[model samples]
Target: MTPDLIILADTVHTLDDRPHHEPIQAVAVSGGVVAAVGSRSDAQSWRQAGTRVVDLGTATLTPGLVDCHIHPVFGLDLTVGVDLSGAGTLEEVRALLRTEAANDGEWLRGWGLNPNAFGTTPMHRHALDDVSGGKPALVRLFDGHSALANSRALDRAGVHGPEEFDQASEVVCDGDGTPTGLLLEAAAMELVQRHMPQESFAERKARLAGLLRDFARSGLTGGHIMDHSEESTALLQALEADGELPLRLRTAPWCMPGSGEAQWKDMARSIGTGGRRWSIEAIKLFVDGTVDNGTAWLYEPDTLGQSTAAFWPRPEDYTAAVRYFASRGIPTATHAIGDAGVHHVLNALESLAETVPADVLRRTVHRIEHIESVPDQLVERFKDAGVVASMQPTHCTHYSLADHSDNWSTRLGPERADRAWRCRDLRDAGVTLGIGSDWPIAPYEPLPIIADSQLRRRSGHPEQQPIAPAQALTALQALEGYTSHAAKAAGLWDVSGSITVGKRADFTAFEMDPLTTAPDEFAASSVLGTFVDGEIQFMLERLG
Candidate 1:
């Protein structure tokens, strides 16, 4: 009998343990299981009258891609106003926002620009208002840690600035205590929120659906959903029940500080995120602020010779949080970009280890996100502790600019940055390397992750050296990071990640020979068709 789908491509990297390193003449799919993977000569035997044969001339096919790390958010306001992303000077920032100010509006909202994004000229409120036609505009800092608001927004929020505001997140004020419109940290954003009401959960959920569709089109079959909230979990459940969730989602819930044990336990159970297209892998906690915001828990203060690092309420916060979830035998994934943060989270795990045996410790797999700079000793500790370094490769590519200040440079240092996303090192040390695209912060697209892993080259700003250049993975290895490695992290290693007989047929077929081509060519490659569980999904036309 002929197979249901007979795809003949020049090369099909079965992506198995010993993948088809050479070209695959044809792949026979029957009942969505790869019935035959061999030369074209035997394909005819497997083909049935109803089989659909796709001739992928000289192209390649592999398992569907998976993003291990990604934040779920809809379209940003990058195009709305003064985007300092590529602006050469602060005047350009003013000119752009000023232009947007021309539109009549009660308030302006924009995000995705760094304070130091440009080498020269910092943005100020005066410049912001000059362009605002009597409306206040809020421009969030590239890093979500901070943002800038005009006088109108500040007035609406009912605070002049940091001095007048009573909160934890730092609000940047002028030397005279006048609000400079710069809202720093989580504390400050709360003030901005007083003025701007966010979308209802239903609105956000609909937007999230759009994002999931985009993910499916990109060949992403699974991902670890961070920054998860109750509303988000409910929506995921709704999608799964409705059978509208095309991509697999692994949901991670965050624990709030000073919150009661009852609160945590209740949310954990009621989350109802797992069991369908979504998986509740662990409890996600933040040990410190992000590096961009000078909140990362570094070993020392920033290069400025001051301890700019910020920690949770206290080590006890993590201790209580981790142990609360840990005692229940649940795995935890913490946000630890700074060494201090990593050390603190590690200490929490060490505390948990005391209660559980070595064997049990391995079962309670922990993950550290965005380890920009871990000490030499910590690297070995990570291996011994059986932790998973859930890191992003693109951060180093963008942050490692030679022109950056000594503080930002020294935080990770050249040595550590050189091995930022130590994918190979983690694997060698017996630690799992789970790669992810932190969407909203980093686009959900996996091509950048694929490009960086295979080529070991930054997309732009090339002065920085490639970390663990020799540790660079091959195209197949990179593909595995998005597939098998990711599946292993989500505790779904046995179900998906491969195109084997028993595994679900959630595979993406590319239209080019990614395994045979160089990194550059693969970077430009596109997806041709996607199949998840015996059904055709997305099909993108490939460039010749």
Candidate 2:
């Protein structure tokens, strides 16, 4: 086949397991798949009159980076207001909220509010009331698992007191049973969210398109979306209608607590449904919530006695749900942060060995997202059961502290806190560990996330003490997390991941060698270009 394009880089890291004695220098693409990978002379032989050859001088090319866990569609709502991810203190949060409240709008909204900023103060409406100018205000916590609605907002939603939920959600009332304005989990947050002003479909579609382009520009060629809905599906389709998506998306629609066989069937039907660059191929479930918000299901209750319950009211039902999907050859990715949550998911997946056909079980891949603080016993079980560990290193580096002062650390106490984000341990145990930013919850930039995986702290902040130094990953492992392991996590290893003959022509070219550069230096380096399906999705003007 005549090649359509040829990408020549200074160093080409195929990252494939197959042994190759020759150093790869060029990759040829035809029909959106890698047609050849060899020396510069070999590429010249394949070059034709119509072929486009681009040389990236001194650039290092590798398999396109893929964030294994992200929520781009959900982020539209989660990031509706001023970004508070940078605020370090309660004063800083209030200052930002006040500035947002001053804007022209009937309601005040903000997101990425760190719970640690509240210090010992309770997450009450009173903190926001003074700054909201009596307007209904809602602020999403950085974890995306909870939100704090100001008094007016609570009254608007008619959340006057405690409420019951099928899932482990709460309205969080005070001693007198009055709502404190803290809403935990999706069910509770939806109560107030439904009342918030809705953005037009056109507006959301534009934002999503912009976000996906940003992903590509940051060196990502694909993402495993952890959340998907009908709206998201439609938005993706609309974006593709205008043009091809900048990055490939493997979406997993959510199957929540109140769902049953019928809902499971609906989600199964969604599988394999998507546009050219996006597809729904997996099911997303939640066993628990975030540790920072006191919603994670831990073996022992957190110091606040809040994170003891599973997101599903009946844990047995969750197991059955997994069996339902596994039997149909559908892969699942569960949001399980705490030890107990991870344990439950592992137990459910392991049960499939007895009930599911051996061939089907082998084909299906199950993943547990955010295994934040599991003990040694649970670490090996991942490899044993063949479960993928989809983790977010930034969740530890950006939110928690080494001294145990952060809310997540303090809640788990010293012992469990010391075990934070065991990336190295899991990898050492022979587990397929895929890393991500969990964007909108944390930053979506792949470079910083890959760096944080090795640094165990903010990449550029060398003065900041590492949260869990022992959990740091090697440079090669960190890159693999976003490449080979990411593909393995999504069950797409055969078609994607590494740069090799017969694989999809997706590649990320960096100005610096990611493997050899120091973590801090790599985090700041530029992405020369990103290609998906043999087409350049993002490239520096100079490169173009």
Candidate 3:
């Protein structure tokens, strides 16, 4: 069959394990799959008259990059206001809030509120009240597990005092039982969130389409969407109706605490359901929340005595849920951040061998996300249980400090803080470590993420000290986290990980060779182009 498209580059890191003497310089695509991969001469001979050829002079090509975890649909809501990710102090946060409050909106909203900005000050509505202009305001913390609502917003939501929740959520009240306007976890946040104005379906669909295109522009050819909903499904369908998606998406709908076997069955049926470029393939569960927010499930309590509880009211129920899905041959990715959470998830997955057939168990792939801090004992267990570690390196580099001054480090204390993001340890233990952006929690640029994995600090901020420097990954290993390892995390290694023949014709072309360039330089480099299913999704004007 004649090739439909051909891409030529000075360097192509196929990342294919099989040894080959000749360097790979060209790849030919036919019907959305790789047809040939060899030297440039070999590619020229295979190309037919109608084949479209792209010669990215001096660019480096690799298997399409995939963010192992992201929340695009959830982000549409989470990222709805002023971006406070850069605010460094309480005054800075207040200043930003004041500016947004001055706008004409009925409700003042913001997101990516870094906890460290509060410093010694407690997270209370009082902090935002003075800047809120008497209007209801809600600002989501950077963790995505908590939010700070002003008194007006709390009052609007009718949350006057403490509230009971099935999961480990909190409405955070003071000594007199007066709500502090701090909401923790999803249920607690929803109290005020439900009162906020909603975006129209068309507006949401347009925002999502723009977001996906931005993702592809950053060299992402695919993403493992950690959260999915009916609205997200419909939005993707609507976007596809206009044309093909900029990137391939593998979605995992959430299964929250109160859900039962009936819901589990319904989610199981959703697997393999999607359009040409998007599909529901896994289940997203949470054993615990974020460490910075004091909702993480730690074996020992933090200094504040918080984070000792699981997200599930009954821990055993989580095990049952996992067993239910594993028995049906569906994979699960649990948000387990602390030692206790990671340990519990591993235990649940390990127990499957006893209940499930050995063959079926062997095929099941369970993943633990945001392994923020875990002891050495839990490191090897990922490989032992045949589980993958889907982590976000930027969560460490951008959020924590080496001096143990940041909220995440201060809460965990010295011993646990020392174990922050054990990326190298897990990889050395023969565990498949897939890295991602976890966007809305952190930035989604793959280059910066790859660089941070090596630097153990923000890619461009060399002045910042490295957090857990020993945990840093090599450049090649870091790149694999978004390529080979990412595909393995989703159980799609056979067809999508590497730039090998017969794999999907997806590619990310970089202006420079990622492996050879310095970390800082690489982070600032441009993505020459990105191709999905052999179709160009984005290309720099210079290249075009």
Tell me how far candidate 3 lies from the true structure as C-alpha RMSD in angstroms.
Answer: 0.8
Instruction: List all candidate RMSDs to the true structure.
Output: 3.7, 0.9, 0.8
lDDT order, best first, reads 3, 2, 1
lDDT per residue, candidate 1, 1-544, as tens digits? 4578877777666656756645467877776566667778767787777888777676666777778777674232222344455543566776667666666566776666655544434445665766667786788765566777888877878877454322236666778888777666666767766666466767666777777878887777667876666566677777667565777677777775556688778756744446556767677777776666566777766653433444556568668878777666677788887777788777778778677666656556678877767766777888666677787766655455433342346555565445455666666677767777676555556766677775566643245556457667767667777877777776666766766655766777675665666666656667776666656656665521
Mark the 10 consecutive residues where model 1 has the least summed lDDT. 73-82
Tell me the tens digit of each residue's lDDT in model 3 across 1-544: 5999989999999988978789889999999999988888998798889999899979999999999999999999999989999999999999999999999999999999999999999999999899999999999999899999999999899999999998889999999999998899999999999999999999999999999999999999999999999998899999999999999999999888888999999999999999999999999999999888899999999988889999999999999999999998999999999899999999999999899998887777889998999998999788888999999999998889999999999999999999999999999999999999999899999999999999999999989989889999999999999999999998888999998888999999999899999999999999999999999999999989
lDDT digits (tens) for residues 336-434 of candidate 2: 998999999999999898999999999999999998999999998989999999999999999999999989999999999999999999999999999
Clashes of 2: 0
Give the alpha-carbon lDDT of every model: 0.66, 0.93, 0.93
Q: Could you estimate the TM-score for every candidate? A: 0.86, 0.99, 0.99
Q: Model 1 reaches what TM-score against the true structure?
A: 0.86
Deviation from native of the Cα of residue 420 in model 2, angstroms: 0.5
lDDT of 3: 0.93
